[model samples]
Target: FLPLRGILPDMICDSKSYIDLLTIYQEKARKDCELVGNYLYDLLQKYCSKNVSSKAQLDDLVSIYCKNSSFLNVVRTSELKQEYRHENNESLKQYVEQLPAAQQAPSDGDQSESMMTPQPIFAQDCPELCWYIGLRLCDLFHEKYGRYPGEQLKDIQNGSEDDNSREEMDTDQRQIETDLHDLKLIGKQFLTDHELAKHQGGIRDTVLEELCRYGSCEIHSIAAFVGGCCAQEIIKLITHQYIPIDNTFIYNGIKQSTALFKF
Candidate 1:
């Protein structure tokens, strides 16, 4: 069973509902099989940070996630199944540009950053690529493992509560507790090894080839590739602008490549 720490951060990092957000994202992704992208990692890092407040609203959390360039690229690339093109495409861009500036009121003559301040890219076109890839990953997990990652968490929580309630714990609770004991086991076993390996087998080399061919390997390399190829379809719906078809153009090209890999 995966622990809350294992997956909660990723779900909360997106602008999804915090209560059961992980389950929701997993379910949504499972149903759509798209919407998977780097936004999950971005959200995990932002919400899981030591200093960040845990009580952020969904929009605030989305704003925070959108602020980061990596996350924005993910969003731009991720795909969505639903078709929702705006009638006034130019108006959408203007509205995005005119989004209220982040409130910067001072507190006690010390300029304390407003918690709800929107990032420059928050109102920009949603990160369709990240969302699509993330969902696809979740769907892959369910198909392979025959269970959602969060189900293990629910089992752990239920087992722990049952253990706590019993005057003398039973074998079932003991077994459940033992099963849920090592949270990282799933990350090491499923996410890193199995899921990531499958993902790599399918697209990792293609992504690498594209990056190398373009002579740029910045974070945006993956973001833009994922965005243009995966997110362009979705953006067509949201913006209703006839985006010119891209012909294998790399957004952030770099010659050097990193050997270290982590999910």
Candidate 2:
């Protein structure tokens, strides 16, 4: 996992939910191993043709890869607005530019001179941004109810409740609905408490809904696929014979597609 210290603001990274967010996240699995394999094989052939054998040459290659591949680069690519491409390198520029005119960054004249509002790395419509916020909200939900979105109802069902009570409260359908509602509430409160509603607006409901519906379950196939990809990357790191992916890899199991984005 990449350190988020400089990737996100201290206010967010220091929050309790942020810690929990690290523990849980949308699975970013990499697929299409053959594509990566082919790419590596080509690079290896090129390397062999050059007859590069010096430690200095290898160190230069590793440095080049490290510079290009980073978690922050992927986040910036996915969340940055196309129009704001020129401002992408500005450290103080807000990552999310969807704030309403009235809530935008304060002008120099509006400053109190000693305090400034901390800028956040959230976007209203971006899937990557929503996933981060939703995961944190899920953590907040866990903090509040002592159960994840869908687990509360499961616990209730297993409790010593009478049949009538179980019939009323324990249905899977009802639990699904409950989970959705609770997650929405938690999401709203999170935005409000953090004063992000005025900045980036509410997170997309679809992201939260998906999280609630899926709960914490993992598809075994996806898990195995991720493990295999990670192992491959680790081997490449150890061997240093072929260039490994420079950063973010997204795999869609359903689509049978994989994309590698260099950060």
Quality of model 1 by C-alpha lDDT: 0.34
lDDT of 1 by residue, 70-103 (tens): 3222223212222122232332233223333333
List of clashing residue pairs for candidate 2? none
Give the Cα-based TM-score of candidate 1 against the true structure: 0.18
Off by over 4 Å in 1: 1-141, 149-183, 190-263
Give the candidate number with the greatest TM-score.
2
- Regions of model 2 farther than 4 Å from truth: 1-95, 98-126, 152-170, 193-195, 199-202, 240-263
Q: Assess each prediction's global lDDT (C-alpha) against the native.
A: 0.34, 0.52
- For model 2, how many clashes? 0
Candidate 2 lDDT over 68-156, as tens digits, reads: 34532322234434322333322212433432332343355644331111222223233343465566678888888887776543433
